[model samples]
Target: MTKLIGYARVSTKAQDADRQIQDLLAAGVRRDDLYTDHGLSGALAKRPALDKALTALHPGDTLVITTLDRLGRSTQKMLELAEELRDRNIGLRVLNLGGGDVDTKTPMGAMVFTVMAALAQMELEIKRERINDSVTKRRATGGDLGGRRPTFTESQIRTASKLIKAGEPATQVAKDMGMSHATLYRRIKKLP
Candidate 1:
């Protein structure tokens, strides 16, 4: 019998997959039929759970995702995957599609997916351009490249290092400097 297998992913451990899992379950996918890869970016080619889910698929089965983006960030990769699924006689269902979910078991769904991929590719290109422009603007203004500014200045770090070398505890020095001991050591390690 054909089955609906769900795949879920999160780019970081800080993010939760509960929402996707719930959506898949609500779509009638069994809990045992769901596979997930946590703390894994869609850009990565090798995801253990994704691999297993693909392997579990067979002819007449449908691979379901909460959204198309869960398949991957690359339009080309997503298209290639759909092609492979098509070749194997397996269908694809994206639950959170724009108007309605796209299930590639139908010709109209296949066509809609092609258009969606083209739009996704364009969006990716636009995002890249925006990032490049932002970096260029920041560089032109000599602004530090987008990261949190160091809480401890170079001078504070230098003094904290000296204090540690002069028999003071690292924890005490860090506490006095209003930062964590690990932060203090990380800064000291970066010092020349």
Candidate 2:
């Protein structure tokens, strides 16, 4: 028998997946067939529960989500996932897609999905352009980009190199210099 599986996600621990799960259950998805990734962003490419659900899908099964964003944070990713499902003979159903819901098993659903994908891609591109422009402007004005401070001083690096050249163990050298062994070894590699 064909099964209807649901996937739900929340980006933070403060958010709840109960609302999405309720909607999925109301749509007739079995509780056992539902997968959830809590405290994980949709933007992340690696989601363990989501992967498990996709792997469990069989041909002719339907994958349901409360919203398209629950499937993916970006349109490109959602479209890629949709194409994968279609190629596998699986159906995708989203509860809140514009004026009506989307079921990729139908012709109208396919068209609507394509249009939405295109619009989302355009929106992302525009956002990228705006961010790039803002960054460029800030750089031109000599604003700090914000990053971590250097872990080792020049004198400390030089001492580390000398210690390493003198056959001192990296761990010992790092302990003597009050730094990490890995940091000491990395500084040694940069010695000319």
Residue by residue across 1-192, what tens digits does model 2's lDDT show? 999999999999999999999999999999999999999977899999999999989999999988777777677788889999999999998887796678999988877887877776677679989989988998999987667887777787887788777998878889987888987777777766
lDDT for each residue of candidate 1 in 56-118, tens digit (9 for 90 to 100): 999999999988878888888989999999999999998988968999989999988877877
TM value for model 1: 0.82
Question: Looking at model 1, which ten-residue stretch has the lowest summed lDDT?
Answer: 143-152
In candidate 2, the residue pairs with backbone N, CA or C atoms under 3 Å apart (3 or more residues apart, or in different chains) clash, namely none
Q: Residue 38 in candidate 2 has what lDDT?
A: 93
- Poorest 10 consecutive residues of model 2 by lDDT? 116-125
Candidate 1, which segments miss by more than 4 Å at Cα? Answer: 152-192
* Candidate 2: segments with Cα more than 4 A from true spot: 121-192
- Model 1 pairs in collision: none
